[model samples]
Target chain A: MPQRQGSLDQAPTGVPLTIVRLDESDLSLKLMEMGCLPGEKLEILHRASGGDPLAIKVMEYVLGLRAREAAAVWVSWGDTPLRNLWNSQEP
Target chain B: MSLQRIFLAGNPNSGKSTLFNALTGLHHKTANFPGVTVESLQTEIELRSTGKVVLVDLPGTYSLYPQSQDEWVACQALVQAASEGIPTVVVVVVDASNLNRSLLLIHQIQELGLSMQVVLNKCDRVANPGLKGVVQWFENEMKIKALVCDARKGQGLNEVSKAFGQRLAEARSGAVSTVPGPWAASWNEVFGQGLETQNLGNEVIRAQHSAETVERYRRINQSLKTCPLHETKAKAALPNGPDRLLLHPVGGILVFVAVMALMFQALFAWASYPMDFIENMMLWAGENLRQFLEPRYPAMSHLVTKGLMPGIGGVLVFVPQIFLLFLFLVLLEESGYMARVSYLMDRNLKRIGLNGKSIVPMLGGFACAVPAIAATRNIVSWKERLSTIMILPLMSCSARLPVYALLIQFAVPEGYILGIFSLQGLTMMGLYLMGVVAAVLSALVMKFWIREKGPSYFMLEIPAYQWPVSRNLWQVPLRYCLSFVQGAGKVIVVVSLLLWFLASFGPDHKMSETLTGQATPPVLEKSYAGVLGKALEPVIMPLGFDWKIGIALVTSFAAREVFVGTMATIYGLEGDPNQDGTQLRLKERMQKDTVGGSKEPLFNRATVWSLLVFYAFALQCMSTVAATKQETRSWKWPLIQLLYLSALAYLASLAVYQWSL
Candidate 1:
């Protein structure tokens, strides 16, 4: 189900979804490449060691996204237990 | 693929990115827009069952007739694509609500006579009944396909896609592109006779317009307002009443101070616990692993505990600080408060012959200088961009957190400030304030130094306050943290390895031997790093830095935190009481360590502050240097930056040392 997590920039983090659209070049381009899409499953892998380059495993490879860009990637994360547990855990 | 390139063009804030995201899906990344100076949004998408098209998001601009670098970037992309004779279709995205304003650009695109379509973006925002005429007028006047699309809501997206394929097919069939207006044709005739030949403004004018654009401008005045349409608008409607008090000259200064204070407090207090935890964990891990290996691998054990532990520990300490600073920034930005700061600063900045936009990168640089340099790209003039780049090193990056943190702990402590607040926080505040002052003064100097004429009037889009998007706010900080760790982390690792090797062995004797001969504190100075510190004595004498401090400086070239690591490496860090994460150990070593015939503190207050000043201003990171080189497309800029920063550092430190005495 496509549920609103709060803002236009974000949806609940879960199974990777296909990239539906990219909004602006300056900000959104940075977000689009961070792995939110129309038909991809993105599991929140973990943050970069510094907790900024938010890491998500997608396309079978780990991707790093800046928080600004990550907010734009409307996602619906898969209900895998390990990924869900890590994503829900408080920073 | 049938060899077609779709160009996406629109004004800034026309929701072009949203449409690009929609069209390209997940199959694209940013690269410079071919050989030109702009970034074109290029991605692959299916057009038909067996056909594919390359979508290029052209840099958004108000008009094809260029003024700024961004506009030049867009215009150049068009010229190159047109010259290439590539099967190209231009997608002109216009904000639907401001039809006339956005259509000014679409008309210019039509003048190019290229196969094109106008995407009336943000149709969702325009509830006006005039929408039908607006779309009708666009279609009737320009004759390109018009799609009333909401890039955000996926409204009219398929129509946009259909227009893309349909336009390109028309181009392939050899249709002559549209022509310019009757008035632009007359304006060109007037300008051609008036050309002074010395002015580039005329050359740009000549190049951008079609044979009859002068007629286009003339005809524009007949129906639409001839002047630039309302210049621009707020992304989310702007508030009518100005918050003049918030942006007044004096109030802006005080506000800047308070903001600086809040940042320093967050840097110092909120980030400390995590820093302490990270430092302790690294120290503990190294110490325990050494014991596990024991006497059999004495050499290996020493390497891990001393060299590796401190090096990595030094870098990780700033991770918390980076997050905290980013958090503050994300808040300020999402709230639309930065525009106010920019607007206020612009009034003052314009005096130094620069735009207010320059302040954006300068303010943002405090978090990290690399992106600050990248931010300079938005400034149009080469002179302004270069000046911004030249002064950015002085902004004081988060790397200096270690040096400043140490200084505050030792030299300045929390106390009565006019019997009111923490003096230490004030001093910390002063250091950041010093950096800002240094940046402005340097820009002023460069203003005089570079003979290029100043920029044209500064125009800005002040986005209005809206409820801070919680998703955007959270994502912003996370993004910065990731970038810092990945970029800074790689450099930190490499530098640590080099430092580990340099500090591990000595000439003709193991590092432990040299340490043992002179070390009075058993655990304090008998490590490889300690011996290395003693060896550094002669070289750093001129600057009043001893070998220990010299090692710290060298290690910090990799990153500022490594200074602390080199200290941890040289001094015994694992509960060795003398060096137990206190300022005392460094001071004792600085004052009593025998580098000369008579003992003296390696650094007095003046020298320490000067060293603090040096860290505050210099771009010492190997990562930043590499990043600078990448950004400027040459070694010339980064090299010049290093030379000037080094000279400034040496001169500042020298003066501080001698004057203090």
Candidate 2:
């Protein structure tokens, strides 16, 4: 399955997306620990009116993330089969 | 027998503190970890089987791999305790509804090879029918006993305590096994994969950690498949009704202002009763004690009535405001609105080198800066936290209110502008606005001045709205207020005593006796304080301050509210005349006084405005300085703060005096 890749900051609200990878940075560990791992499914739930900090739903919880942190996480959004995405990326 | 230790560890917002409070039941004391500023709570609990054991509540961390100082402290304590081979039991409190994320930390602790017991907290929030299977899976596959309890309701807490007793007993007998759980195989896979990327760079190490997280989640997802536990997702979203308005751009600001207005209204309106009561009671006690002891033991009477009682009273007067401020903050935080405030204010705050989390501390500064400085602990980023602490004292705290009131009454004539606003009231508001503008400009300056220690991230957790726990409402405020009294209260008392001694006697006894025989002014003029004031007069003369105002300024360093009392005593009035008639009489006396024996009034517009500007900007409160030192754990920042604020105060007051002239 083919997918369109984008950072979480640009991802549309209420649309499901799969995390592709986290940019190598100091905050990656914190993001991963908060369940923002690759192959995890999440959706942008809401955005602040000024649009810096965003609320995203992941692992049955809503996490508030700033735009800078959201840019670190690369995600893919499409009408692709969900199960095939992780299996295809497995080492 | 020596007491065994049971260390409670968990992620933030996991109800770990709630569980600790329920287990210890108001018998815990907060103390800093050795060589670190992070505070942890410790208490003794008696189990039926085992004797009393120490229960230590570690600071919350998302993982054993440390990011912030708090996480470092938590991880270091566990590893050190383990390496020492102390008889310890680690009770991992996991949020039941967020089991997968919680297990990530559990797996990290497992790799440490410590005796661990799992307690699933907030079980009432998890709506999974396979919750039973989730506990069973922990027992069967993980080889770790799992206990379920709703810590908020105090359910299954006794059984949790019983498990702690059993674990401690086993730990004492050296029979507590650190067996490798089922997660060991996956951990081996993670480390084995990490070996290939070793020594590449710092980024590689970060990448390896990320891989480990991915692997742990993969394992958790695979293992929980048979049990099929799904956390109910219906309650996860912020309800569309309230959140719509709360997160709105314009609406959010309006709501924030309204909330802040209500808090301050409640603070000043309600706290005034207790503050007045404390002031009047202290005056009565001091007056009676002075009359009783002045005749028999003059020295003892002066020390107790003048030094000790007033010092204690000054510290006690701020308690009502501090308690109310903390109560409002705790309520906002526990109900989940505090996070939204940070979310909404992040953009505007970022422009000044701070973030949304700075709003709470900034608002808390208006009540008092001691607890407000301590409140900076919630800010994880060092630069932002330091910046927030730097500008906080500039917010025109309640201590400066009296100084501003007296000055405004003297400086501004009794008249309205246009038709509605009183001239005096507008002047008071202008002083407050000046403090705010100064704070904003200072923060802007500090933004470029302070270098970032690392990349700052705002990874806040927005939990669902829920009613705050009834017990936490009082306990949290009570804990903070007690800490304030212990930390800042000491400085106020010492400064008070030192000021009393400075004002009581002079170096030349014969000259002091000759001066004292005439009146209070002559006695005060000859005292050491009066000598020091005369010495300072030349320096402050450019700002329109005379020797007497200099004395009041020097004495008010203990606290700004002491300015009125110092003025009263300097004018031959015996006690603090806080009442209306006495204040009016003092005002009349001040109105008659002249500048340098000239016909011009001393409390003229220029001098009053200058004094108001000085009080608004000066770092006069010794308690705030002490608290800043304690919170930053260094003298460097506090020293920088005092220097910068004093410089600002001097320049600003000079400008006001010259411009008014």
Candidate 3:
């Protein structure tokens, strides 16, 4: 399916997105190590009161990243057909 | 043969510590590695077949590339062990449920060419088919031996120990290679090429590294598919449902407030009885010792009962509250609620150049800043970590509770607010809130004014919520309590005795008159401490404090809670109506006291409030200074902390005193 690339923080809550690329930053390595690799699907679970730190589920774990940090993660906005690709792979 | 040292390493929250404790039982000692403050646990275990080996549990790390100070320490220890000709075996504990992520670190360790064994911890959480496949992948594909064990339940531990014992025997017999293997060649190829490139940030180099990481994940995923591990049973969905309400904007805030309120209430109300019991025990011992020794050696007995016992008691009395605070903190961490707290607090904290992780240490500061500053290792950004450490001392710790209680009793009138709440309770709350405000403002100043050039990043994993392990819940708090007694106990005792001596002996100016028992000024007035206080009188006079209060202030630097003990000793020495010293409470003595040569009370409104304000802002505890030095790895920051906080305390106390007058 065709999709539009956007910052992860811009994606609406509850919608799934596939991480396409992470911008070069100190957090890029850490994010990648946390299973946020390119082509991995994730969903925004919830947002805090001020909508700055968003909780996202990836690789069967929830991770919290502020919007500025989330901005570095470029993700494709679309409903992933293989929604449970990462979760299904979990042992 | 000499004893072999085994290094245990793993990712954070991978149950490495649990495994270490299970293997070592209670035969373990936690000590800082060399000069660093990062704790390493060492234990001796005598295996049936392998004799005895010393197991050193290194700090948890995500990878060989260090991210935080703790990880750096772990990496350094591992490298040092390898470089030195130590007969060492490295055991990497991996999370069975998250094998791929855990394998990242395992792969790095393998490249280091150490004889390694992998313990697949938390096997109970994984399906049997998945567990079999993981074991097969490790044994067949990676050419590494693996043991499946549930460290939490102590399952498969015997097999693990046997495997380790067998491997240790093999390594000792020179059957296994302890030098760099073929994997080291590939490691050099990957990282060496990246370093040799002139354009470090070139897209080509980044793409190459990304491709390498992606290839590793692909291999891991492909290996998992080789076995018939199905997703028939759904993962437990319990925490998610409750998280909906707990993480809601309004509900979350309300719940956080309620949780904190409950914690503080327990620290104050529940801990009070134990504190009182400790106090009474100290008093009883002091009185008995005095009675037994006063006849033959009055001066020696006075020092023992009045000086040594009270000083040690003052330090021990705080143990109960500190234990309770850590009890709640450990429960929160083990249950995984602490991660959620960081998530919730991140947005607000980011404005002050901090993230959610800083909130844990700040909240911890309210209990004590020593451990709180140690907690800052979780903050990845250097700037945020420094600012957080600098502002942590402003939080009112449990040590301030006694001083505040004494002052509020004398300064604030006993009244009811709205005929429902006690005015004194409200005043106490206001003082706590004032410290928080001061901390926040100071952090803001640091964020805007302090020039720190570094990329700010915040990312944290919110682990799945689980039932708090009863063993861990108790063990952690117990360890912290023991650490407090061991670490801060010596400082408090020595300071207490020195204070006692200074308050007891004076200059020999009237030697002949004293021998004849002629009338002279009170002994305390001519004592070393009294003279020191009188010398500082001109400096503190503007804050409405007299020489005696000045003396207490100087002694209180050993620990803030010592302020109460210092006051009690001075007033007891002054000899009021209850000259026996056991009858008068500290508050009673303080209330009856009057300014010298004046009818006015010494603890007037202006003076009491000024003192409260001073203590609230001052960095009065020596232990906190020592901890700050250890954490920052320099004396400069702690020295600056002392000067800045002292200046702030002085000016703030001056304003409050002037206004109240």
Candidate 4:
């Protein structure tokens, strides 16, 4: 089956999505430095009441990201359940 | 012996400060980096072998490449120290459980070619077997010493101190530079060889930073694979249980409201007793001093009893309220809850060109603007920080509470609203609400004109909530109060003395004549303050204020609460004061006093409302102006604030007076 893909902002909450790429260079750098690397598995934990800043768990830490910044991050769900790289043993 | 300097750097929420404080104890001095408001804390640590070394806590940053003010300060301090050839050892504090991500920063610092050591903080939250492997990996692959520490628990801190001692000893012996890893070679290949200062555009620099981060992460992941580690075995340290309720869309906001309500309840209910005690103590001391000095030296007696005593009393009286407010502020901040608050309020505040962090200072503004302005340093965006400072004085502060009380009592009659709430109480509430509304509207207006310094971002880390450290609970508030008393307190004293001088003496001969003719208090018409008031009367006439209220307004520049005292002195000098120091007598005198030429009452509904509205909006506190200048590092913002708020006050009061008439 073809993998599902969208911006991290539109990804369903509680489902582990693998980061494909970040759209903006500045944000991509910050996100990557913060351990949101491509192929890293993350899940949207909570959306703030106004639905702009979403809390996402990645690299065993939760980070608050604005939806605009989140939109720059593209993520996808693969056919196989990808283990959290920072958590599980590396392949 | 020359003091060896060790710089501690880390990402935010890495518990770097906790480690620094634990290492240095309570002996550190916080100093601002030469020109900026970003505070740097340093203390002399007596290492077991090195004797004396200065441990400086650099502001937390995710990368050496800077974004925010604090981050820039950290970056500059590190690079500047390196360029200046200071014998410095950079100690990178890393969150042990998040070792892979933490290695990225470690790589950046090492790539800077600075001698570095790693202190894995929050190791208590990590499994022992995995933590051991991580330490071995750092010592071997990175060729840097690593020590495990639970900084919060003050565990294994001795090992950290010893590691720093060895690093600094090595540096002092002319053995400098961190062990150059393969990644450093690759980084040099990518971004030129040496760490020379480069003048690059922001876009190009950020793009470079992006490239560097990706490469570093890849290297970090590669390094992690070679190391034996079971990070999944680490117990989950996330505070999911409390965060569920605290970060809930509706429940979180309601919890915030409850928290604020409880804080205010503590502020008003508990702080009032100490305030009253301070007031009465000052009055008693003044009365006794006056009795002793009145006969021997009348002029000295007047100066000491009337001028200095009240001036000092005015400043000290607010200490209790300030202390209480800071206590609550420190508690909220030290606990991880403050981060959640910013997260909740981020979207709404963004509309008005403010960050979620702006909420901390805005809330603090209710207690006092001096500290509130200082609190804006944490706001990343310059536009949001500046706008927050500008609107801070608009929040009805504790000083204005007394002014509101005095005016509301004089104007609004004692009656129940809907047979439940007091009309006078409701009026006070309305005035407070008016301030909040004005501040919001002002910020909305400010967003259009205040240019952004850089692109704003709201990326924040909500750290796991924990019981606040007992020592910081009291120390933080104490430090704030001490700074307030030292900085703003002096301004209050000087302004009060100046007001006293202005109110007591005239241009020439008039003061003695009025004093000898009347009682001890000089006649209001003859004093320099009275002359100034008469000069100002025409300007304020549209707001239904006469020369006497004008004198009060002039004195009120010292503080808004000074208006009540000024009015009492004015009425006492002109009217009867048989029953001295009774507010009732002052009230009756103000009630009976007429307009200069007419039989109409001086303080009718229109005049009272006008005065109340005027006081609500005016920038009456010199301390607030001084704070704004200090925080902004310029006089331009403070001057603009004064002019803008004064104009707003004048127009608002004019409207209120005219509409009420």
Candidate 5:
């Protein structure tokens, strides 16, 4: 099945999503280097009270990014379960 | 053998600094990289076989491709060391649990062709197979030795040290060229070519670099597959239960407030005993020095006892409080909780035109603003960083602690509210909160005024929490205390001497006039500093300050805490001479000091509160202004910072004095 493409901020919390591509922005390179490259699996773990900076688990680490930066990171909803994403190695 | 220099490089949060501390113990010096505030720590390590070697710990960076100024510093140091023909061995520290990703940097460093070793630090966090296989892969495929070390536990460090020694011996014995002159030249050639191609514009080059990095990671993953490792299963989820609650929207804010309240309470209560001890010790020393010297060398004794003693004592008395403040801060940082603070503060800070990362520097500003302003380098946007630096000094640093302690004694009653909170302690906390509020308000003003055109992003990695190492707990605080003394001590002493000279000698009359015993002018009023203070008195009079306070306000621009020592010196010099060799306590002297015509004490409630308000809002630290200039690379920001904060201080003090009266 074709997957829906949207920003990581729009991705459902606690669900796994695969990063499609990080848009060409100043932060994209840093985000990519921080293990947010295309094909990497990440899940939004928590959103702060103001709902701008969200915590996402990626590369076996929890990272915090604001909604503006997260919007630059385009992701596709993953078909695999969050449990499977946890068990599988980086493809 | 000549000492070989080894560079330790790693990604941030990769246990690199922990390893450096473990290796060097107490024998290291931290200095800034040339022209940059990023600290480069170099230490001499004596290996059993290889005599002495210098280990340079570079600031952490993710890649050779520079992102921030900090990363650029690391990259430049690496490239410069390679080019300088230094007998250098590059040691790349990688997080063991995150081997595949860590290899990306190793690959970049390897291309530099310098003698290199890979340390898979934090090995204890990963499973045994993962650690062993990575080591084996590095030794066999990459032809580089890799050691699995738990820097926290000091595991596998001996092997690292021994391997380093062996590598140095081989290089010295002409078996290999550690400097790799030809390899460096070739790498530079490629780098130069890349720069030439950068006419493609920054976006294109950045995209190219990102694609290249992604490709490199893919290759690293492919290579890791051949190692004898089991399928990596995310083990025992990141001990994130505490984070969940700590990062909770409502709960997190409450916890942050509670943590800050506890921190302030500890600063006041826990530091009081040490402060009192220091104060008493200073008094005792002064009494003994005066007794010992008055009969022997009266003039010399006065210089030592009255001038130097009070100056040095003022700086020393705050050491305990400064140490405690840093101890708590270092503990928070080493435990990985500080990142959470950034996360928690990000949303609120965003409203005031700062990112989450600004919180680190803001919290750090509480200890001191010099380093705190330097710490703003990590904030990506120029606008956010500038605002953070501009407002940082408003956070009451430990330098202001002595001032507050002295003034709060007079301003607030010793009574307690609800049978628990000391009014004095509450007032201290209120002053700190007032600083924070003023800082936030000023930043809000700066946000609109200073127009920076660029996107500001906040991305922070919340590392898994670890128990802070005990040695590190003390080392960090000790380093801060030492640097504080070194940085602020010299200025305090020099200013003290200048003040002493000013307050001791009046306009030089000839020897005949002194011999004729013409009634000498009051030394303080006729002295240079007193004259200057009196000259400025008309401005400060509205805030209830006499010329004595005016003198302190002028001298304290060197540092906030100098106000205490300045007062001590002024009072020590002006006090009655035949008081049985006992100096009046500064607090008592201030309390007894009455305005010329009025019976009211000089440091009454209105004046004391006004002074507190003034200090709370003023940018009094010269070092902070210098740091702001260095960090912002502009005189404009620091000048604007000084002018606005002074205005705020004046207005605030005026309002407070009027309201209290």
Candidate 6:
């Protein structure tokens, strides 16, 4: 998983970033049900209706996801970028 | 060999729902949490290989003493859990965003002598500024274990649950304990009794109270110094004043006007299309069912056209509007704007002598009174909470929307009024404003009546306005629609069928003579229901109601929305005037009542206006009454509300009728 700008042109495509956002309150309870958590690895493969929703693969399913939920998901480029994020929050 | 019960309780809006949804993951179980109608939603999970289990997710509460209805319910649940001989665990959810303030409640719960754990909720908002140091410092000083969790995100879930779980087990096994003779004993004393621990319910409740719940809350209360993160916590000093310029006496009302204007504009703009789609769908279903049913099928003739179509159609009309209302409310609530609105109202609300805390319940009153009553729990004083509960129903709920819509359509002229105002919009606003004003005035009067002073504290956290959480926002409409489909659908269907049966065949009408039976449709002139309607026509004459409208009024007692269905079902028939009058001929049958010897429409302006006024004031829903009784835990209050509303409805309708006449 090398880095690439997440192009919306093809199926099972790749993106270098994680989630940007989830619709406020909608993805909180069903975190896995949606996808990208803050600092998690995710990619958009293909999108329908000009990216109102996109099919993104996460934890083995190409789940249909809303752009709003995807937006709250903060991510970084590189498949292994999450190495920096897993640092336990300083107690 | 022992099972432990953990009760997660905190003030409302402290991420309680998120935590519940977190632990349970729909893997949870629900029953009425013991001692309150409010659900005791619990999920039991076993730590594999340890053979140890724990329950999570209870109700939210501020104080364990039970000042408000929700608080009372939460307290009772703990009581029952203690009595059950299961080691009870309490997790006090503290809003990290509002630490010192919420800690006041934490201290109280701690003082109550119960085993507890503290959750520093909304920890994601903690920016790494010196606030982190503050959190660490508080933890060092408080001598309690504190875990920071963004409950909304499942952050710290495994760690916190496991840690708190281990602590609870330790407390239960007599390894760690705090001082307690059962905290709710104070409530028992307040009720003029000593804690009779042996009473099964009390025993179960007290047993769970085992000193640990107290230590846990006390430990957490002193541990978490909640300072706003650098980015999330920045603020400038507000303009110095008793009130902002926006809330100036005259200027404030203008802002209120503008806010209401936006709400009305949205009511039409946002909901109109969805409404049309629903109506069209209903019409489509009706026509399809009509064509599908053969003319010769038994019960099929009246069934498709009258029995089924109208019943379902009536409820479907409200669905789009309900969804739209929830959508707007969710958006407003999620955006942090609902808090601002509540903040804006406090000054004026206080002038009218209401506790500022009452604003939460009053605003919530707009949605549904039952929850509005439940929402009153946050008000610290029982006097304010009780009075807030008493006046909450005056605010129109979603259930009342149909009655208002129909009455507005029939009575208020669609044309411009006062040369410039849209009369319907203005009327809707005015009616809603009336509820607010009435609630305020009622509170003011009660202030004099009860003569109690309220604690005034301005301590509040302005949570840095972040974009609203998406999960909580979208969950609203999905949950609303699901519940509405289940709850309102079943009731409407049953009522529809019952009404069809009632209006279809009379006690004495011959088959061929009835409208549905006869090709030319003979007389309903002799049916039992028809005779009763005609006889009662004189009583309703002054108010402009006729037999059909009277029938609708009678049927609508089951719930307010059934009024529309009753009218649709009865008038849909083409049966006769006397005997089979309950049939489709009802619309025509009602046209010529000739009240006061005039050839005017039987349901004229005066009568329609009176009916509108009546609906605005009436306590017509059996379900709301049942909900109120359940919420309040007594017949006296609901009975009083019913009597007052009925009297108010009748008097107002009479005045409208008499003045018009």
Best by TM-score, which number?
A: 5
Backbone clash total, candidate 1: 61
Clashes of each: 61, 0, 0, 0, 0, 55
* lDDT tens readout by residue for model 6, B552-633: 6766767777887776676565333566422322234445444545777766778878887776777777767886787657
DockQ, model 5, C-alpha based: 0.54
User: TM-scores, in order shown?
Assistant: 0.67, 0.83, 0.88, 0.83, 0.92, 0.68
The 10 consecutive residues of candidate 1 chain A with the worst lDDT sum are A82-91
Inter-residue clash pairs, candidate 3: none
Across residues B1-661, which tens digit of lDDT does each residue of candidate 3 receive? Answer: 4578788899777778778767875454762211112467787898888788888888888765555666766766766565566667788998666676777777667667667899988666655623776677677877788888888877888998898887787666656654343344443343344322122334554555555566666766776566444332335332366677677777877898778767766765577789889878877877788889878776567667667776677677778887787778767776777778888888778888776888878877877787678878767777788889999999998789778867988788888767855667667777877898999888998888667555566787776666766666666666666766776677666776787767766775453443234534246788888899999999999999999999989888988888877786776566555756464555777888888868899999999999999999999998889988988778988998899899999999999999999
Model 2: docking quality category: acceptable
Best candidate according to DockQ: 4
Provide the lowest-lDDT 10-residue window in model 1 chain B: B231-240
- Candidate 4 residues B1-661, lDDT tens each? 4567999998877888777767765564652211112456777878888787888888787876665656766777776665556678999998776777778778778766667889888776555633777778877888888888887778888888888888887777767655554444433332342322222125655666677778778877887787765454432223357777888878888999778766655655567689779778876887788789978878777767666776666666667876777677667866778888998889988998788878777877776777678767656667888899999998888777657655676688878757855676567657766887898888988899776555567887766666666665565556555665665557656665676677777675456654454445445677787888999989999999999899888777877767756665555446354457432334567788788868988888899999999988999988799889987778999999999899999999999999999
Docking level for model 3: acceptable
Cα shift from native, residue B158, model 1 (Å): 9.4
Model 2: per-residue lDDT, tens digit, B339-369? 8888788887888988787877786677678
Q: Is candidate 2 or candidate 4 better by DockQ?
A: 4
lDDT of each: 0.59, 0.74, 0.74, 0.73, 0.78, 0.56
Q: What fraction of correct interface contacts does each candidate retain?
A: 0.00, 0.72, 0.50, 0.72, 0.68, 0.00
Question: Residue B638 deviation, candidate 2, in Å?
Answer: 3.6
User: Please, what are the lDDT tens digits per residue for candidate 1 over residues B1-661?
Assistant: 4478888887765667657765654455442211112355577788862278888777667655555555656766765565577778888887664554455566656665678877776555444523566566655655666767766556677777777778888877768466754434433342344322124344443433432332343444354542222212232321123344454457656877688787887787678789878767775776677778546666566566655666666677778887777677666754556656665565467557566667767766777776667666556566777778888878777777777876666557567757755676667777887888877887888778876553333344443454443443444455556666666667666766666666544444555653444322233334455576677867656666776677777777777766766665665442344545332333344344443445544445655776777777766777668767866667987898888888877777777667766
Q: Which sections of candidate 3 miss by over 4 Å?
A: A77-79, A82-91, B1-3, B21-38, B41-54, B127-133, B154-164, B177-211, B227-239, B412-427, B509-522, B579-583, B597-599
> lDDT (0-100) at residue B163 of candidate 1?
75
- The CAPRI classification for model 1 reads as incorrect
- Look at candidate 5 and tell me the lDDT of residue A48: 81
The residue-by-residue lDDT of candidate 5 on B346-459, one tens digit each, is: 888989998788887888889888878877777767788889988998999989999999999998778878887678888899999999998889899989998876557788
Indicate the worst ten consecutive residues by lDDT in candidate 5 chain B: B177-186
